[model samples]
Target chain A: MGKVVLVTGAARELGVRFVRRVQREPDVDRVVAVDAVEPVRGLGAASFVRADIRQPSIGTVLAEHAVDTVVHLDAQGAGPEGRAAGRAFAKEINVIGAMQLLGACQKAPAVRRLVIKSTTGVYGSAPRDPTVFDEQTVPGALPASGFAKDAVEVEGYVRGFARRRPDVAVTVLRFAQILGPARESPLAACFAQPVLPTALGHDPRLQFVHDDDAVEALRLAAGEPRAGTVKAGTFNIAGAGVLLLSQCARRLGLLTVPVPLPALRWGGGVLRRAGALELSAEQLRLLTHGRVVSTVRAREVLGFTPRRSTQETLAAFARERGAGPLPPGLLGGAVDRAAAVLAGARVRPPHRQEAERND
Target chain B: MTDAKVIPFGDDEGRPRAASTDRGARPRHRPSAGGRDPRRGGPPLSSVPEQRSEADALPPGRDAEQQGPGRQETGRQEPGQGGLLGRVLGDAWDARAARGLAFLRRRLTGEYEVDEFGYDEELTDQVLMSLLRPVYEKYFRVEVRGLEHIPSAGAALVVANHSGTLPLDGLMLQVAVHDHHPAQRRLRLLGADLVFSLPVVNEVARKAGHTLACAEDAQALLTRGEVVGVMPEGFKGLGKPFADRYRLQRFGRGGFVATALRTGAPIVPCSIVGAEEIYPMVGNSRTLARLFGLPYFPLTPTFPWLGALGAVPLPTKWTIQFGEPLATDAYAPEAAEDPMLMFQLTDQVRETIQHTLYKLLVRRRSVFF
Candidate 1:
């Protein structure tokens, strides 16, 4: 018999999209979509169950559906909007909701597989951090507080649940910064700005996974182990290669103004107060040091490789946003012309040759 | 030599004039050329006088018309200018200018690629190396020896002595490897975490292909077949007083050896002379160092008293010698874990560097020669 899958955070766009994709999966007999509020659009063949996972009522929804697979994606603070809802509310939905959901999963005997969507932020950015983080690499500095902390706590509860239910195949996918045409992540919001403010003296290496790849990775984790795929384990899900923040800014045709670290923090507060892009402490650290994770395990064991590389993912996102004020081609042409003019002038003077010969 | 090849062209252009002016400028450049000792085997220095005479022979107004864009295509009125020599020179100059412009365009458009570690190979080669080349060539007059010991390709660990209060030696060593080696290999230096913690230094260090002196980064670079350089002495050797110059400090915990053993890359002990005399750290202030959060506040003879001018490193002749490689592949795979094996290997490497330093010191004629 095909398995009954329950996906949390169904009202959200990513959740709705994931629910639609999972409903079409050959092994998924039924998809029970759960969220605190009703989704705006139809979930296609999947059934939407409006039940908040923070309360014990989520247990009734799970038991009623006889969910054989649980994809817990309701952990908040994944996007800027979630963070804008206030820190406490996001934490309650993330930590408390995960705890309640995991508790319900532990009691459900039919749930043989559990997949939790995690963020790479758990591996906090620091000066001493390893160049690339694999699944086993410990974070250089554990995040004090932020969405990263929430994810850490949620993963802790998931670990507890896994230990309690050894029979269930638990998969935790730590996704890097997710970006796509439809996504609205903190990084995406930062990129959308015409003028990007970056931390001074930092051109951090960044890794990104396309939103479609993220959903695909979740699907692969939630489903049964296909041929050549590992049954269950934690995997870092990110596209291949990396991009510097400066390179990203150039690609997006955005003018980046470098602000000192302290002033950046102050400016972030001011911007947030004015209902602009909210730069959390986690994001500030990320902007400064950046984080990159290795997806070798995901490729080798989980049998999932992202379709787009980091550069390609960003390019696709830029394409969807249309042309910025300064298109890359125009900027490149202007630079090339300016450089040609300068070089022509330098090589023009015969006396310059005498000066060079003297050196 | 490159000088001999250029002389034929100079003779063709201004043979009579060169002979007349050669005598006058020849004596003036001799003293400067003699400053570099001939016993120190390096790139031939005889080219300096020949090139200087060639430049002196050229009439300053001869190429005035060549500056105009219209005159570039049309043959010069002079009989010698229309030959293959002039065409080749003009084409070469245009090509170089075009290449430079293309590089600028790539940098502006962010079209270049950096490795996962943020090492920008193009920038390091085209910009950073050229910037440091003058100091490496003219200022220090670095003479490199035993460069053949480095493999033409594949991974190798270079353990060198660290000195000079400001760490200019590391950069000079990088230049030495890049310019002198047969393979023209880039040295990826393993630096202290403090170098990475700072603001501007952090960005430049990464761009110049220096990573934190941690085992993970070293192993990764070695596995990728990069020539990794590490100064095990770190702050200890760099901050030592003038009295301790050339006395090798303790190699820290044999970590580099273990890393080499694990990766099975041969360890090449490099001894760099003249770096110790650059700043000549006479004393260190603990209070100032603590207040500034520095390892040591160095007090040199010319420093603190000279203010900003004190930062200029003394022009001391330098010689870098790469010793024979110590093979780690012969050892058992688990040998890296054995503390005894690591200690023996580390000691062997350290002694080799210290011994070579003494030898180079004895051979040196003078510090500022």
Candidate 2:
């Protein structure tokens, strides 16, 4: 018989893709998709459990379902709502919820593999040059208040559990920038907005992993049978190449305004002084030093390959609902600007409308 | 012979002393080079014999002298009698003839002896030091106005400017003291938390004896009367990009000065040159970095592995110059409490290093080492 998998936050982008990929895999017989909200669409052959994963009783419900591979991915404080909710909420959900899920997995004797989605925020803001962060680099100083509290609490629980339960294989994938469909990530929103120019050009390089690859990473985590602290064991799930924000903005048809580092430093200073941007003095240090992650271990241990390029991935995303004309920044040349207009022709609004009428 | 002079680089004043006829480190009149008579060179304790006699006994099975002193001797017959390549070929011929004789003696039953690569110190030091000099000359080269500022003896804190660039400045400083300074004292550098955590790298670093650049480690090393190095900027200075390279990052409330003030070690301001040009981080992606729990995205030329890991670090030349020591011994025990004094001292050290680096840059005629 194939193994059953339970995924919390099934509605979220990473969790949704996880369910889809698992269901397609021959080894996975069923995926028990859990979420706070009901699934808008059904996952074939997979059971859907709508419940808040943070609650204590959620574990009993998961145990009753006979989940064998519990891929826990429920949490909040990810998006804009993250800042509004006080520090305690971040700890309660990202941390407490994770602990509760692990408890549930332990209760369910059938649950063999527990895969937790971890963020690279644990590495903190130290400058490490040419040093590949593998399953060794510990989380440096906490940069921001929210990230500091959440990353610590989650790692602490997972680490403590790994020691006690050597039988249950636990994999914590510290993922880099995640990008895919249905991602209302702040960047995606930024892309959708009619910003003429992106601030601070040539300041930071970004790596984004497509949603499919993100799911593949989760699947790999489920298959692995190892019991160790795994340290950061982080991977740069970013898209195949690194690109500047100006380049991305130019490609996305947004304004490519270049805010030099000096100006930003001055502006940041003023903003901090004026209480416009709330960042600690230490946090500001990280703003100037660029962050880079190595995905070497992911290929070695997880057998993951990111198929989508940043350009293709962004193009597909730009086709999402109400994502009309390409932004001005993306209109690099006159020829490309014309091509972008033509690219919008593939939007297929008529086909959608026809399908809606048929339904 | 008169004692050899100990001159700090950028010390323009003429001083009289004996010059070394050999390449080896010569002794100076000042007693601080561990009070070992200037007449004697290296450690007085003879290096454990080339081959520990079997009958003389062993320390332990694992401690069977894993490669350092004995192995190097057996491996290389001093090169330049006919140069490195000529010696290798000559050795290979001898091995070949010996193998043929052994083959006949064993009636062709014996296995062939495998040749393994061994460490060549003189060659390695020459290559590594030459490769590192350019990086040192560009950013760290400083002018020492007074050679006498650094005491002839005891521990000293080399406080200097800190910049962003992954503590390349710190490493360059350590190499400078070893390679260029007259004393050739091995500067024990204190590293940040991130550096010690990396794999493969962590192994090489531990062998080099780098501990966390924490106050405890610095104090401990200094208390042993050894030179301890630190960069007050911590993460802040290291993270800065090329545009902000020389600009000193915040000193993190001057804890390093406090450490020096308490220890009574003179603070030696060290200026590092050429570290900034190694890699240029052009852009950062905060949104994406946050997803992965990282600080910011770095868009340097070789990184993001534009194909292979070899593209990681550009072999930039390094030059590090140590400045006149900032004396903290005269201060009262509670002197660390004076923030104004600490601030002034930090600025002075930073300015000195910065000025020295600019002067060094002017002296450097080329970009690549």
True contacts kept of each: 0.44, 0.00
Which digits, one per residue and each the tens of the lDDT, describe model 1 over residues A1-359? 99899999888778888999999898889999999787757899998888888899999988898989999888766432533477788888999999999998888899999999889999999989777788898877899888889999888988888899999999999989889864635687778878888899888889999989989999989887889888588999888888888888888888888998889988888887687765677888898888778788999999999999999999998898765666778877876776577466555566655455546
Model 1 Cα lDDT, one tens digit per residue, B1-369: 111111122113443222221221222112332222331243334334554454445455433312221122111122233223333333233434345556656766777788888898878875677568667766777777787788989999999999988888899899888755757688999998888878778888988999889898899899999999999999999999999999999999999999999999999999999899999899899999999999999999888889989878898888888999999999988999999989998999999999999999999999986
User: Which candidate leads the pack in DockQ?
Assistant: 1
DockQ-based class of model 1: acceptable
Show pairs that collide, candidate 1.
none
Specify the poorest-scoring 10-residue window by lDDT in model 1 chain A. Answer: A76-85
Task: Kindly report, for each predicted structure in the order presented, the TM-score of its chain A compared with the true chain A.
Answer: 0.91, 0.73
Candidate 2 accuracy as TM-score: 0.44
| Candidate 2 lDDT by residue in tens digits, B184-273 | 555666666555444334323433445566665567566767677788777666667768877777777777887888899998877665
Could you give the CAPRI-style class of model 2? incorrect
Clashes of each: 0, 52
Instruction: Indicate the TM-score of model 1.
Output: 0.86
Error of 2 at B333 (Å): 44
